[model samples]
Target: MTASVLRSFWIGGFEGADHVNGAGEPLDMAAATAHLELLNGDYLRAREHGLLTVRESIGWRLSEPAPHRHELARAVQVATAARRHGLQVVWTFMHYGTPPDVSLFDDGLVERFASFAAAAARALAPLHDEPPVYNLINEIGYVAWAASHTNLIHPYVGDPQGLGEHTEASGYDVKRRLVRAVLAGMDAVRAVDPRARFLHVEPLVHVVAPHERPDLADLAERIAGYQWQVWDLIAGRLEPQLGGHTGALDLVGVNHYHSGQWEAGTERRLRWHEGDPRRRPFGALLQAAWERYRRPLIVAETSHIGVGRARWLDEVASEVANARAAGIPVEGLCLYPLVDRHDWGDPAHWHHSGLWDVDHDTPLPRHRRLVPDYAAVLTQWQARLPGAPPLPIAPPVPEPLPESRANGVVPCTT
Candidate 1:
């Protein structure tokens, strides 16, 4: 399928992760960034800037606080807002967070999440003119790695010392569970609304041995291989018993970030600039994914923080342009966290990673200001890309959020 299915080649992603952090604190990024309180303005800003397609989420923890008990009225409200703003949405059912009673390791998580997925589809199916697109689970591979190999996610919080061979094995086991969850969730949604579409999003990465440690080349290849495991599993190429099939691998989304490539053992990121021969072009990675999956692809998520935002986009846009020109059929590029967000574990620190920056000093309902340079770069790419939305003659100037506006997002149940 082509990008013609989407409203535009540019997509804005709202920061909707509700994952529990390393500190054991549950995070609601959409609420923290004031996106929930300022939904209309946020969606309007994206549409005004020529982005008609967006990625959104309905928190699983909040939507289903207890087993088989779902509260999706608020989620439906959010979907209504998107429809009102004339934007097409790709809703993320889960973003690395599960209910308080549910553990990632539980054999029952797949069924629990599948039930929630069906409930969500039932609530949202009527809002869209076309079949609503759903990203069943965001970054399954990364979530598994974080939970097992690192302490950033649950089941491993405050357990950084366990990052050795045992943890590495655990990571794969967790990945298998996540893949099963995705497959079951896809089936559940289809049962509720057969026309519902799905997007499987995962990190796109490259890895290499440290220059001094040439003997570690094989190890580096194994580490890089983790990136493909999620896709392979969903395609039934790796494990068919999970109920995966070619249909489970729908619109493939590859999220690229500056830290995506690195030296294996030391974890030192390969420089995206300064002539690192080991660094691969983003277009090459996209091509490799297409050739392997033979599925239509999109850059599901990509952005940089502070000073690098525009430059990163320039590189990504160039790579995407080349990929499309070469007949890759890469559909769209989404600038994630359309508005800036704070670090999950350290809410005091803002990433300054979005087209709009949030003011931390302000009280509840913080103000968001546009980054002119980033907008200019985005506009330039919009003009260059075929079938892109028309460039706005002038950048949008966001007004300060009113103090009377209260945070409408459901409180975290965890």
Candidate 2:
């Protein structure tokens, strides 16, 4: 049989956003999730739950602190664990974490990124029997907006130039650089592995004019268009741009969440549930995305915090099924942060959003316990998927431990 692009329709992703926090402390999710230490167990847990495809990030800063000099220890461990557990991994080359020395606005950023990609491809080739799938940079559009528009990264608005800090104007420079880096990185990776596939993952959002500010509808629509700019440039739809052609894009990996929709002028987040009239149906948005790009798509990232978690997953499964039946060519739905993660800015705030609820208070992989409510819903959803296999029976734990300190995902579900 020909090798499948993804092992199954339902996939799981580790939250690998390696960004600098507000206090200038580095936040490494790989460390937070206890991924490297229990990497095999995590893969095993996903496999038993019938999630054979996993998404993970290889930290750019940790892997290659300097240009040209590459380190593949972490990436290799992740790949090896997946291979051993019979899983297909969606590797992300850069998850919002760039080396300290590499500046996003510098002229040579593209070249440096391409070199890094080529080095990574060469290093990862031995583990994979086929061309590996990659999300080159997780949500570059968001990254650009955060860096230029918000106080997230460098080039803050408070700089001495009197530049308009948090507006659309700041996005031009950073967005262009991100596009160039992707275009250059694609060429470099393809040079090493001809069959390599890429996913341009961007956050999908909806904007509505506030009741009192109907005139702001246009502004909301314009901001919504920002989501498509990166894909547009790659598809040759953006005019006066270079290196973009019809087939430049391979897949559309959209990262969406309950908070995606918001007021246009005021930017107030609209509640996705509770029958909000302004909220658009997920299937409708998926259809729109398909009509525009004409490429296979995946819900790359999605989850809700607290009790809304199970309800959200059920809704997403229904939408994905509807889209597939309607011939949208929808590939998969990934449960992002399969292992729970802590807040980037405030460590005290736990999202409680993962199938596995991890304890972020204690240091070291802390405790990754299964959220029984969410896992049950996920298992049922998987059974209804096309080509989904029977979930393997989990091995019994030596003794009953408190729910707070459960070790593996599947075993904890009992």
Candidate 3:
């Protein structure tokens, strides 16, 4: 028997402007509108190709710039455009960036966030009745890692001296506080849209190596705790020592990038490596999530850095199919960055990870043009199901003609 495919789309940045830069800045309204136009065009393109659901974000930082004042005109425009294109949106309320003035550790922050989430739901409820699925935060585990260990983001700078300075304590505290804030936010939304559902997104960690020190192992366990802890909290199974609360997750969203593998030691040998097709970790992550949470799961973000996206998507789609055959309720998968985006903070350099490559300088061709890796997935999936319905085709968008006429894509041998 053939499995049914669930189509979906992801729109907007996690936090309005923060997603574009490590430094939190308010997104320019005009520029943001133009970006939305690009996103809408991508949706129209994808729709022509056969996708139905698009997940977009409602950033806390952008929604409520101040305690009571709400700013949602931009988000509304995006959401409305998405609905017009006949797409279902899964609204992610928080994706890593909170209001600049709010500290994750503050109780006030939690209350304020809850209020903001409630406000957002109220504003958006009229557009659709099936209250949007609210992802409380994106990758809480990664957020904690950024603030506590890697110092890639705010509040921490990876200071060696500060390493011993409340790193673990502060990290855990911030995580717990954020979860509470999410719960509060959900409660507020329920007041407006009782049918609303919650989505908890986190990175799945594959510990490749454990450090020699038992303490390091314990720390790793604690970090892993962040993933399961919210589930436990919501299911009313959290230990008192963890300062747990009830009702933190309703759905599970896993963001599995190729770079999620980790190695532990004092030197911190964490590196993101593409896995062999025969041993993909994304499957393990989904299986683990099913065993642990038993909730609906979605691949929130799964792509590779540079130009290997096609193979990455094929492997991920196959894994999803396998998991579904095994009775896992794998609801949907979203291809992130719908189009290639400029580097987070540095707009000059392109990430080159989109299905279609973008050159700011010139026009590009639409058909007979495929990224090698993406083309591989397209061929494999087609071969796997020769009679499958073709994805709805969007009118050909312009693309630069390929310098070479190669039509075949190389499968990854590594």
lDDT of each: 0.81, 0.76, 0.57
How big is the positional error of residue 221 in model 1, measured in Å on the Cα after superposition? 0.7
Residue-by-residue lDDT tens digits, candidate 1, 1-414: 334456788999998888888778888888888888999999889999999999988889877877899999888888899899898998999988899888887767877888899899999989988877889889988888777767887546535565532222327777888887887777678778877777899988888988899987988888888888999988879866555677678778999988888887787888775557898899999999989987778789999988889999999999998887777877789998799988887988888899999778875446879999999999999998754432222211222222321111111112
Q: 92-200 in candidate 3: lDDT tens per residue? A: 7776666777765566776677678878888888777444677767666556556665445555454446543222432555666666566556667777787676767
Residue runs of model 1 more than 4 Å from their true location after superposition: 1-3, 155-170, 273-275, 387-414
Choose 1 or 2, whichever is better by lDDT: 1
Worst 10 residues of 1 by lDDT: 404-413
Ranked by lDDT from best down, the candidates are 1, 2, 3
Best by TM-score: 1
Global CA lDDT of candidate 1, please? 0.81
